[model samples]
Target: MSTITLSSAARARATGRHFVPRLSWLWSGLFGCLVILNIAPLIWGILTSFKGQADLFRFPPAFVSFTPTLENYERVFLSGFGGNLGISLVNALAAVVLALVLGLPAAYAFDRFNFPLRRLLFLAVVASIPLSIGAAALLIPNYVYFASLGLTNTPIVLPMLYAAHQLPMAIWVIKGTIEGIPRELDEAATADGCTTFQILRYVILPLVRPALGAAAILVFVGSWNEFVASSVMVDSPSLRTVQPAIYSFIGFFGREWGPLTASATLAILPILIIFALFGRLMVSGLTKGSVKG
Candidate 1:
């Protein structure tokens, strides 16, 4: 019986060693697939931007173009595309700022206070998704309402919509982040004669930044890529954002492939760059939020 037990234990150890390598290989394959999935589009976009309108529609897609030109980049920078990009940047930045500002305070309140209906109120916030806004069905009335407020065809409206759209998620993200931080830090700061405002500003804000950055980046990308909301609400030529810019590229006459692709590249680049720079923080924010939820 002792010999049988020893043999069984040795067999188990061998099985465990075999399983570890298999798991490691599986994880490596998954990561490689994720990287390739993300990068392929970006590389394809670059190639398409270089390709002329005809080359883009070739019966069989070709990895190499016969002639690549700078027209796309030139049109993006020097042509009317520049203004659309500016508007997109403005909209995205404003929405992120608005979302963060409102999200932080609301999240703090929900996290700390347990007053009447606290959980109910928190649920209300979470339940209010964009679908509840009824934007598509309410376009006309919404326009009339906004016009009454004198917000029609303005950048303010985009940010306002984006802020509202992002608020629920942002609140949740910041709340989770703030909870992870020890309360002792706040108590210690207060004991050191820090005011409520000072304690929040110095201690809580710094600690919660990763979550906030993650929230901001998400909101910014949404706002930047926003199409229906921006197009429906914004009517003025100067006010139209990147989505409209892309639409304009494919007019009734013909699609401006090069310039359109170039603009697309530019539109996507900033968010990618942001992701690259703050990768660890984003991962932390995502993981923490998931675990908390």
Candidate 2:
């Protein structure tokens, strides 16, 4: 009886070991398919951007090899797209900077301080996430106000709108990140006579580096991709952003597909580049507090 029991236990261990590899293979293939599915459209856009307009309507779509041309790129540059690209860059960067300046301290306050209506205010921040009010909804009022003030088509309006739009989300995200950090560290700093701002600038900020990076990326991307707001806020050619500028490829007669796709490819390039460079920071921020102190 003992020998039979030992034999069964050994078999069970072996079976479990064998099952893990099969399960891992199954999950690997499933996630591989998912990754490929997500990346396919982006790959197609890049390929289409390279193809000439004649190849666009070809019977069998060329996935591998096709004659590529730079005419679309040339057209994009010659049509004042460079100026729009610069506007987008400036707007995104400025919005992110403004958001961090305003939102980070608010997040820290929410996380560390006890105040009246704290829960209610935090809830409001969270609730803003589901609010679907778009730029069109506020366009008439903003247009009237800005026009009255003679601020229409100014360089500052779009960035300010982007910062306002992204502020609540930034506060909520950073507050959550701050909550994950141990309060004991704050107490320790207090015991050492560190001022509130010093603790924030020295200890809290360094620990929350990942969250700041994530918020910056989110705000930047949101500002960069915003079209309706940019279109409504600034109609001046000099103040237009990349996304609205892409519409120049369309005309009353016909849409220029090649230049449109090329511009789209260019619009998405900065986002991809930003992630490629700093994605690890976001990952680190998420995992930094995972292990117990």
lDDT, candidates in the order shown: 0.80, 0.85
Task: Give the Cα error of residue 213 in candidate 1, in Å.
Answer: 1.9
Across 92-149, the per-residue lDDT of candidate 1 in tens digits comes to 7887888898889888888866789999998888876452233465567777888899
Give a tens-digit lDDT track for model 2, residues 33-60.
9999999998898888888978887878
Model 1 scores a TM of 0.83
Q: Clash totals for all models, in order? A: 0, 0
Please report the candidate that would top TM-score against the real structure.
2
Off by over 4 Å in 2: 1-18, 130-150, 182-194, 289-293
Residue 79, model 1: Cα distance from true site in angstroms: 4.1
